[model samples]
Target: MKEKTIDYVLRATWMAVSKMYNEEAGKAGSTMATGFALLSIDPEKGTPSTSLGPKMGMEATSLSRILRTMEDKGIIVRKRNPEDGRSVLINLTNFGLEMRNFSKGVVLRFDEAVKENVSEEDLRTFIEVAHTIMELINNKKIYKPETSAK
Candidate 1:
């Protein structure tokens, strides 16, 4: 049988992991995206609305939807940034902070479980390979189309 490509394996693993997080978040009355946003925001200081999307690697539309839901749920609040009049900052509510802690714990537990099962060397190698793949993509080193195709 032909072996699976690295991209296939990476996509499959991420899908599985995302599903797992979504399931856990559902039990906590949240979605994976919401949980991730909560985790990305600072607990003490607020995060700029404009910065959150890029920080989370989320599109503006998707992030806007999630932010709306979070605001409706009273998980977060948007306030005008004192530092920048044009920008808005996203701040977590009391409930949002609690949810953030829950999300953090969930992530930590998953990491701990993986570390328990996988050898340290293997984990390091996996991280290195993942980083390399990210660098390659970020640098546009792969999949360059011919000039005629452009």
Candidate 2:
């Protein structure tokens, strides 16, 4: 493992970013996942509980636990979705709105700081590389048919 691979860099960078966000969230007595959830919910109209999992790329049990904690903290409330009687919508409370604003500011500041440091050309190239990697994975190009088994 003398030389690093692309996945290593991606994982390490993401881990660092996650840690930084968690630290920032700790100040407000929250976690990065909660902050993410707060941002994922629609500001005006509430978001469906079922959709939250897919939107956040989280699991049902995890989302349910976070939602329960948020509700207990008075940050959000669950109400019946008008359009779908069987579904429930998660609405942010006034405090949740304030928290969401705070979370947004943190993210904006992070983006601004990163943009200030990275040149536009480098940033564009980085984005293109990332997209290419995603495309490769999405199209199942990495692991293919037996044609390349040699």
Candidate 3:
């Protein structure tokens, strides 16, 4: 039997995880994006609008849409930053905080389940491999073959 490529395994795993999170979020009257945004924002100080997109690995347009939906749902509020006149801050409402806690619990439960099923050594290796893959992409090592022959 042919073995699956690493990328394929990674993508498939991510898709399955995302679908699970989305389903859970849907049951809570939210989306995965909303739950992620809620988790990303600082509960006390709020998060800067510009910083959230990069922090979430999301584009501004997509984050904007999510924020709008959150605001409409009374989950978040946008306030002008006192320290930076040109920037806006995203703050969670009381309901948003509740949802954030729920999101956190969901994440923790999933993590605990994985830990219970997977050995610690295997989990550590998986984390190391994931970090190495991320580092390769971040360092532009994956697509630098054109420069290799020079």
Candidate 4:
């Protein structure tokens, strides 16, 4: 099989999984994850949208809108940075933490589903390929040719 074919298969599989998982997740899934990601980083220090957007590959404007929604829902709190008054810091509220925990359970159930559906060998291969893809895309690294031992 060609490398491009492998990429296509990987993308298709990802789409399928994501679609199913998102359906299961409903409105709570994506928003919950965003809130959880913010909480997971620095509870006390909090996270700035400026930093979080680029890291998540989300646009600042879009992130702001999401933040607004989360804020209205009481999922997160926005505080002014005392030192840097211009900066906005985001933190998860107790309600947000509970939602994040619920999302965790949903993700765990999805993991079990994936494990049951995909064989061990496939799962191993998928993990290696997924990590390679992440390293290539997120880490901006290239894949080097592996040398075989004689």
lDDT at position 2, candidate 3: 91
Candidate 1 lDDT over 1-150, as tens digits, reads 299999899999999999999999999999999999999998898999999999999999999999999999999999999999999999999999999999999999999999999999999999999999999988888976558755
lDDT of 4 by residue, 17-87 (tens): 77765665566646444543544435557777568787666777877787787788787898897768998
Q: What overall lDDT goes with each candidate model? A: 0.95, 0.94, 0.95, 0.71
Question: Which candidate do you rate higher for TM-score, 1 or 4?
Answer: 1
What RMSD value applies to candidate 3?
2.2
Model 3: per-residue Cα lDDT at residue 50: 97
Global lDDT of model 2: 0.94
Query: How many clashing pairs per prediction, in order?
Result: 0, 0, 0, 0
Model 2, TM vs. native: 0.92
lDDT of 3 by residue, 10-91 (tens): 9999999999999999889998889999999999999999999999999999999999999999999999999999999999
Q: 13-49 in candidate 2: lDDT tens per residue?
A: 9999999999998899998989999999997999999
Candidate 1 at 39: error in angstroms? 0.8
